[model samples]
Target: SEPFLPFTAQKLVELFGLEAPDWTQAGNGQLLKESSSIGQMGLLFEKIEDEVVEKQLNKLQESKKMNEAANAPAVPMKEIITYDDFAKLDMRVVTVLEAEKMPKSKKLIKLKVDTGLGHRTVLSGVAEHFEPEFLVGKQVTMLINLAPRKMMGIDSEGMILMAEDKDGKLKLLTPHEGTASGSTIS
Candidate 1:
């Protein structure tokens, strides 16, 4: 009778047409000499299986780390600034007179806002999250003192203040009560 071997060893021996080892002389180590080929093949398969398992575990651990990082805060708090620096910012309430998507731009919207001081042309990157029609007539906060900058060949007079939610959606910052356009935000 042949020595009992693992299923994998038996399959390997049958697949490769190898002779079965005698089990009667296992105490005398005759089985070891006769079954060396099957034992080696079994060991190779076990090593390959172990390596595959290790690679899968590594992939799962990497995915878990990425998920944790994604769940962390999107932005950290900035350094504290002096009251004078804060006062330097001329933040005002502005009413959107007109809004339209910028030409050849996917994220920019051109806005004509009434700052109470005068009408100002402002470019904001909110087209992806908001429609031009939705912004029209909406009252929102703005920083009016920023030096005018050219975007897409047009001058942008001010920056609109917006807040981002946990889901990464952007929302306009508006006064709780109706306020006159150009009114300073303290």
Candidate 2:
């Protein structure tokens, strides 16, 4: 039988009802030096500890990256357009003449706005973020040249410009000072 290391002898006795081999009487009658076994075990344990610590650090770094990505913009920047293409947009300042939440919808708001051209109906998906009364008489940016579209049985004449934060909160875009109802926004 091969000579058993001192530590293996104790474990073998505890796990199985087997007698420990006498290392001094085994093949060649030589026992492994206890100091060498202890040193190897210590090195093995140190390697295991290092691997565990590295795994923990990797997990922490991945968690930090996930948090940063959550706070970043939801969409990437759009493709750039030429100056003439941008100039084609009829963006202007408009005053909210009247506002009300649309029927049968939680997100839509029906608004009447003065685009300096005329009073027009603009449907915006902002009812969840803003109250109808809060929008009344507020001067806001509008894209006035968009082809009119029908929503919920109403013709939406333009689109209200809004800003969104990382948390998905929406805010209407407005000028710093009060602007005329129909002022052009260059």
Candidate 3:
């Protein structure tokens, strides 16, 4: 048999010992349960271990496991900072009174937060992760002392903190229990 070309559809079918789809039977929907294209691809992938030589198959399986492990979520710690630097940030708990998408901005969501400091406007780039309706009434950690900046023409007074996953999902940092609005974090 001839060597298979890398990543080719024929090679994939051969590598997996899967029956190649009969293109003529595609529209008839008789080949597989899934949509015709996906059904055939799934069947091909399913037979991979069977088609590949035992030693090479074992190596491929190991490589796949390593790749999956490499994709696991991990965040590298930031460079160490002095206590004085840490102490300078006025981090506090704040309650979200309202969240609204900023006009003309794809990523910005303007939030009305109640920090014991007062009801302040904060702009966050989390529109992709959160809906305006979902943010209301959530208590979150914020850096209340950050200098005001204009975003989407609105004055953003603080920043909300969030934990980000490797795949770019963000989870806002909220206290484990109810805390008063504007409670100091440290």
Candidate 1 residues 127-177, lDDT tens each? 999999999999999999999999989999989999986567899999998
User: Candidate 3: minimum summed lDDT over ten consecutive residues — where?
Assistant: 36-45
Model 3 over residues 1-186: C-alpha lDDT tens digits?
223533466755454454765555455634444433432334433445654778897899999877876788676779999999999999999999999998888899999999987899999999999999999999999999899998767899989999986557899899999989989998
The model with the greatest lDDT is: 1
Q: What is the lDDT of residue 91 in candidate 2?
A: 92
RMSD of each: 10.9, 12.7, 14.8
List lDDT for all candidates, in order.
0.86, 0.82, 0.82
lDDT of 2 by residue, 1-186 (tens): 124465555554444333454555455424343342322222211245888899999999999877986878677879999999999998999999899998899999999999988999999999999999999999999999999999988899999999997667898899999988888878
- Which regions in candidate 2 have their CA more than 4 angstroms from the true location? 1-74
TM-score of 2: 0.62
> Model 3 compared with the native: what TM-score?
0.62
Which stretches of candidate 1 lie above 4 Å from their native place? 1-71
- The residue pairs found clashing in candidate 2 are 116-182
